[model samples]
Target: MATSRLGFSFLLSLFLAVACSTVARQLRFVTVIYRHGDRSPIKAYPKDPYQESDWPQGFGQLSQVGMMQHWELGQALRTRYSGFLNKSYDRQEAYIRSTDCDRTLMSAEANLAGLYPPEGSQLFNPNISWQPVPVHTVPESQDRLLKFPLLNCPRYQQLQRETRQSAEYVNKTRENANFMAMVANETGIQNISLESVWSVYDTLFCEQSHNLTLPPWVSPNVLQRLKDLKDFSFRFLFGIHRQVEKGRLQGGVLLGQILKNISEAANTSRPQRLKLITYSAHDTTVVALQMALNVYNGKQTPYASCHMFELYEEDSGNFSVEMYFRNESGKEPFPVALPDCPQRCPLQDFLLKTQSVISQEWDHDCQVPSTSQDTEVIIALAVCGSILFLLVILLLTVLFRLQAQPTGYRHVSDEGEDQP
Candidate 1:
């Protein structure tokens, strides 16, 4: 009886140990990257549904809907990280960063409003729901012009040029002809650019309503078609199946940052995981990062779309990273499961399991296949053209040497006078 009693105690202790480890494994560190919430178009082209006057808040400002969207996101974070972030905010534990844009800044603020609501000592006023915390940012001008700057990376620009010029992209644009005609009809504008068509499409879709005072030329069929085109474009940008591989590569920088952060967190020795790392930037910021991580799944990644990456250290001290996305849809985010790990995969192993994903996602060609289709030939042609130009210049120099006047030899006229 005594021996049986000891064995039961030991088993109980083991089970408790396992359960504790499991709970710890469930929680790791977290890094979230998100775009700002819904807002008006930054600026409309010559023809768009909402003129500046249409919105009381003006263009690019976060709407009340946007605020609610972020507030929901914050609440979600609070729920998700309830045990992790503590009931109160701590400077040492949590940090938030936002782009200088009003929408993003405000979005982050709204999110925090949800993440860390006031409780106990943290509350300045007893009646308030939350205490205010700082959301960080650099100047918008600097962000746009310099520092993590977009100086038109020649490589990305070249890729963009190639992507735009690709038969697929060109054809897609051409197929959008009906969309162009429809926008032209609505705005009463002549010769609408492909981009203008998209701008108008976004305007109408975002307004969530058709123009009440539609121009006489506007057709309901055209409106429906434009809406379809808009959906297609959003799918092209963020959908799982449509966005090309190259875009996934071009936007890998932010994804790289995500992995790097996980790696750092995994390397740390403590119960404290990276509480939070918030990225504040444009819609492209979210898209690029998502594409690199191969997570966007070709959705529009609306303003203030936030991606949460979590890493949990297991009982054996192994680490894993789990990815989560919030897009103001108030739905559970799409999840990417890494192999050799649980629902929450270890960071290092996640990186390894996902290396192929990263490689494929970003369109890196380091391991070119033995065979390829037309793209390879186009690449070969460019390379050969470059090499041929170099060779031609070399040949020209040689020919000039063979046929040219010798040094120290001068031509003389019949009078034996050397030419000057």
Candidate 2:
């Protein structure tokens, strides 16, 4: 009976240990990247009647619906991570970054209002439900580090040119040539191209979403094609010829920064003060980050869509990273998978997979010399030579004319004149 009792106690102990080990996953850190909420179209097509005045806040400014969209997203985040975050606002616990655009800035502010509503004595104002939270940003002009679809990278521009020249791109263009031509003719938009079609779609999409009547030219099929082209344009922007290199210069810069933050958060010796960091920017930003992680679904991320990176530390001191994207306001954020890894990938493996795309010198890689550089130099030298040739001809003409004419002081002998 004593032996049986000892055996039962040992079995119970083993079962308890197994159960504890199974439930030991702890969330260490979180990073979120989200597109700014809805807004008026940045610009309109030639035939578009909806002017800036049509929008309540004018063009490119966030609408009231946009504010509510972000506010709700913030509340969802609050509920999702309530266990990990503080009950009240904590400055050291969270950091927020946004692009220097007014829409994105306002969106961040709105999001923070929902994420951290003051409680207890923290509420200074009784009527207002919002409190101020610091949002950090660098000037858009100098912000190559965080911005996506980075416009200043010369190498990236070169890649775009190459991609356009690729046979696949050309073939796709050919396939859509008839459709694009029809769109241009029917819409009365002059000089329309595949690249600029997205703007047209955006305007129409915004109008439709806001319940404005669309032009007769914009049929269901037309809308679908517009969306397809827009998705293709985005893919062509970051992919096509040398996708990995393009990602490194554009998305990978931002990814590198995010990785550094996660790495710091994972360091157990540190205070772990920063539990969350949120980036509020554009749809392009969300797509670029996902593309860099090899998880893009080739669809345009909806407005106010969010991509979340979660870090978990197991009991054995191993850390893993998981990614989720909340594209729809109604549904839960879905898990995203990394290439050749599980949905919840080990942190070390995540870093290793992304090692190739991590840019060492962003400015250097972005300025990578191409054959076009030589072409530019040649063109410049040719221009200089042409100018020099013109100057030389002018000088020769002046000298010849001077020699042909008599000087101000001339001798009486006309045939062989000499200065007195």
Candidate 3:
């Protein structure tokens, strides 16, 4: 009887362990891309009262509110990933990257402060609670990863031109003609198309967020219209037409990097120690990424919004990816499902589905057909070839005539000698 009771307890303990292991999936890797916190307007319209001098740090700088926003977001991230991440900052286990903009860099620092406050041995100074963490960045002109609407891409520019000519774009333009004219007149911007209108909206939005009194022309209804147009512009730039090709040129650049990281994490044979990677970027970065995933909701990404990718390894050794978007403060991030993929999408399927947008050679892909330089080169070559052909023809004709004349003259001389 004693032996049977002991055996039963042992079996029960083994069963519970197996059950717990099966119920909990092992989170192997985490990738997070977040928009920078609140910022001053990038630029003001010509007629606006506020100029670069009005902002505390001039145009496009991060404000103090932006700093606090990132700090809160960092704390939230810390809480959510407390179990998965290290208690203190570990350079070996985590990497952080930001765009080379002041706002994004500052936001990354603020977030790091909240995410990894100094603890124990890491505490350098008694007065300060934060420890420095490295944030990597490349210059904006060269940064193809985080910057959206890559202006240097001629093919992307051609696509934009095509998008502007699309029926939907035309219809939107016609419908908003009067409103656009009003904005143009009031803002002193003569060419207020969909592309340039967003700047006006951004300046107003930033000013309102900071409790500045807007002009009478910018009524609540007008502001709402501007916001709607701004959202539409986001969709227009990324998704209006030839979306797949545009994705290949724009957002796919960043997506390819992300998928590569996930692949490395999923590799069991050659495992990487890094568990978390974070990108501090702008709202446009968020839109570009979501657009590539075919999951953008057509709403402007808010300040400090975070898009997270969590990779998990199941008990059966299969790996999966789950996505979450944390747009609002004080709320749980909502799950984002890839189009035609399950909520917990298998790693292979995710990669296979996204392969179409992943450009193997981004620079080569951005090349436009019949570029002006190419056309000029072709024309120059054709002109030079024609000139060379004409010169050869002229030389050949002159040689033939010279040979014929010499033969006739020699025959005449021989006849004259015989007569003598």
What is candidate 1's TM-score against the reference? 0.72
Per-residue accuracy of model 3 over 1-420 as CA lDDT, tens digit each: 999999999999999989988777799999999999999999999899989998899988889999999999999999999988998999999999999999999999999999999999999999999999999999999888998878898888888989999999999999999999999999999888987799999999999998988999999999999999999999898989999998898888899999999999999999888999999999989999889889999999999999999999988899999999999988999999999999899999999999989999888888888765388899999999999999999999999888777544543555457552
Best by lDDT: 3
- Give lDDT tens digits, candidate 2, residues 1-420: 999999999999999998998779889899999999999999887778788889987888898899999999999999999989997999999999999998999999999988998898779899988788999999998787667788887888888888989998899889998998888887678877778888888988899989999988789998998999999888887776788898898788889999999999899888568899999999888878877777889999998999999999987989999999999997899999888999989999999999888998888888858566788888899999999999999999999988998669655767676759
Query: For candidate 1, what is the lDDT?
Result: 0.65
Off by over 4 Å in 2: 1-11, 370-372, 375-420
Residue 404 error, candidate 2, Å: 43
- Each candidate structure's TM-score, on Cα atoms with residue i matched to residue i, is 0.72, 0.86, 0.86
Off by over 4 Å in 1: 1-21, 45-50, 141-151, 188-193, 209-224, 227-250, 269-274, 328-330, 338-343, 353-420
Error of 1 at 127 (Å): 4.5
**Over 4 Å off in model 3, which ranges?**
1-18, 370-420
Candidate number with the higher lDDT (1 or 3):
3
lDDT assessment of candidate 2: 0.88
Tell me which residue pairs clash in candidate 2.
none
